[model samples]
Target: MSNLLKILLIEDDAIEVMKLNRAITSLELKHQIIEANNGEEALEILKKKEILPDIILLDLNMPKINGIEFLGILKEDDTLKYIPTIILTTSNNQKDLLSCYKIGVAGYVLKPLKYEEYVSKIESLLSYWSINELIKV
Candidate 1:
């Protein structure tokens, strides 16, 4: 692998995960996608890794730990702080949007309910990251 295409997906929904995986594969990104059901699980994955991901596609709602709280903790840690986190969630609340930005999320992408829209959004995100040269594996 080129180390330029590693993505960590912190999502609780299995179906959404599958859709995302298919989208990334279709893009021919040469990427590795890692899944975490919640913030806590995601943190453990980060701890076990020597190098952080190029990007994180995070969901807001989860069972054990919510995305807002997770972002709070992630932004505080020096080692994990630099990894860019993009909120890929279903929330459209002004408060949630404001709060996420306040915590320093790189981008906020609303979840697309429709299949085609979902694929489009994911591709755009991957393209943006690739163009920016942000992937560090």
Candidate 2:
């Protein structure tokens, strides 16, 4: 990979987390993944800012500050706003999509039911981000 990413994965589902890890390992990517159980936890990680992530993979339906709320918070912060945030979610609701886009979410992707499809989406998502010229803080 030309640009290995430090990805912040904010997801509440344990199974989803495992699946993402499995996909990365299967793809043999060298990127690092930092996981957060929910949006609240993700904020704590971001607050430290020890090293901001290259990209954020967020889930829409999470407990304690859902994706929309989290995006609103993140976009308001000058420093954090530049970090690309992509929604990896099961919700393809039009309202949800509009809200996220309005809040300036970088990307929105619906989770596929099949694992193979899921892997394909993840691969594409990572591939795009890995090559893009990202802002480094």
Candidate 3:
């Protein structure tokens, strides 16, 4: 059976955030998404540990602690390291992609220019994860 996902989206851009929400709403998916404007804010949210997210969608660029650096810190933690983190960024830089993989990111997806394409990608990504067995702890 497919599970309802609790998603954490760590993104700095307001438009990007809106677009993700739009996609989810238009697609009629019932997954819950929690927003964090940057890596720092995301860390704060995670530190509470009251309710851990099923998966994390991270952005490469931000004000403080970019995605790669944030990933490093998260991997060092015993509990946080297990949550699936997908790089959801506009960066198509080879180095960034390689770095994310080296640091153990679950997936790396580039944000498409077209809204329709972006929606399609989001749907597929969410669909796969919702049905996949995710580590709750």
- Which segments of model 1 are wrong by more than 4 Å? 1-3, 135-137
Candidate 2 C-alpha lDDT tens digits along 12-113 = 999999999999999999899999999999999999989799999999999889999999999999899999999999998999999999999999999999
lDDT of each: 0.86, 0.96, 0.96
For residue 103, give model 2's deviation from the true position in Å: 0.4
Better-scoring candidate (lDDT), 1 or 2: 2
RMSD of each: 2.3, 0.7, 0.6
How many clashes in candidate 2?
0
Worst 10 residues of 1 by lDDT: 128-137
Please provide, for model 3 over 1-137, each residue's C-alpha lDDT reduced to its tens digit, 9 standing for 90 to 100.
77889999999999999999999999998889999999999999999999889999999999889999999999999999999999999999999999999999999999999999999999999999998998888
Deviation of model 3 at 52, angstroms: 0.6
- The whole-model C-alpha lDDT of candidate 3 against the native structure comes to 0.96
lDDT-wise, the better of 1 and 3 is: 3
Could you tell me which residue pairs clash in candidate 3? none
**Candidate 1 lDDT for residue 39:** 91
TM-score for each of the candidates: 0.91, 0.98, 0.98
Error of 2 at 133 (Å): 0.3
Tell me the tens digit of each residue's lDDT in model 1 across 40-135: 999999988785688898999888889999999998888788889999989999899999999999999998789889888988888778667563
| Pairs that clash in candidate 2 | none
